[model samples]
Target: MKRTAEKVLSVISLVFTVLSVIGSFIFVAIMKTFTEGTLRTEIEMELYADPELTVEDVDMILSVLEYFEGFSWFIVVVLVISLIATIIGMIFMWNEKNPKLAGIMFIVAGLFAFILSPTSIMLYIAAILCFTRKPPLAAEDQSFIDNQYDDSMRPL
Candidate 1:
């Protein structure tokens, strides 16, 4: 059993997961810079252009930017773990060993698959294929059966 499709999907998922982790880092850096920069103050002033904007609301918005940046590290860590799981699954499938366990690993990785629907979808499909696919049944040789019949000589 080659498991070509599953292998391809897993590799693709691994790449996507890596990209997602890198993107998370970039996102956190950008958010941190935005929070600390004068642009934030400019944006605050712009929002205050609307006389209806209250001090509490402005403070909440500023705090949210910082919190989002803080939480992005958690996202990066999750994505890294997901990448590791995906790689382990790929290795198992590549060697055509322990496919059921590989599928289970994929499912576990899919739990936090980097917030990318396509990547997660690919992982899930790979898992399903691993679980449901089976090798073709072995066929007995006809020539051997004929030789056995000739030796027996008596038939019902």
Candidate 2:
């Protein structure tokens, strides 16, 4: 049952990681379009719609967008890092050799992606469950391993 759960979690993580990469790519494209295309016109229309608006108001809004444009690459870098971390974590989980650690890494990576990507919450929950649940190691098998390693070196 635990192995089944771990497999499910690994699948979920893999899906989320792929989605994160796609989402990041989409975000970058959208941001590029916004900066280079109709966003300025939209902002100008909105500002001018108010009868009290002045040149300074338009300048302020354009300046803010310019500032955002300058930092857009930074956002891209962050999303790329998140995508890589999530993919690596999913691969580790799928191997199932160290699921607890892999699950933890996945959860952390998912959370990071979720904050910026908003679509990774599902993966984060699955990873959390995998980390919290007891693995399917049988008691007898655990005891055998314990004896081989000696009690002092055994995991509690």
Candidate 3:
């Protein structure tokens, strides 16, 4: 039963991990396109609409946008790193070892991804459950412990 539980948890973790990685990549790509395309155009238009705004103001605004663009790249890098972590966690879970910690790490990563995009919330919840639920040990492994070294041997 315990082995079965472990296998179940492993499958769950693997599924969620893959989801998180794919979601992260898609989110980062979409965000980058939006920021570079529509968002940049909007900012430029906003600056142009204000004729009273001096050249210094426009320069400052552009500078800010440039900084934002740079920061957005950092977010993409973070997403890549998160994808790697999720993959590692999936591998650990599939092995049916002490993957609880790995599962928890993946859950936290998924939560971070969720903050960036709500689509990742499902993966976050699934990974959390995978980490928290204790897997039952194999029957043979638990029999000795479960039997309590024979009830008859107990001191009355």
In order of listing, the candidates' clash counts read: 0, 0, 1
The models' CA-based lDDT, in order, is 0.85, 0.64, 0.61
Give the true-structure RMSD of model 3. 7.1
lDDT of 2: 0.64
lDDT of 2 by residue, 6-89 (tens): 466556655665665576567667666666767768867888788887889877877877777666666556556656666666
TM-score versus the correct structure, for each prediction:
0.79, 0.59, 0.53
Better of 2 and 3 by TM-score: 2
Candidate closer to the true structure by lDDT (higher is better), 1 or 2: 1
Better of 2 and 3 by lDDT: 2
lDDT of 1 by residue, 62-139 (tens): 889889988988888888888888988888888888899899889878877844578888999999999999977898
lDDT value, residue 59 of candidate 2: 78
Model 1 earns a TM-score of 0.79
- Ten-residue stretch with the least lDDT total in model 3: 1-10
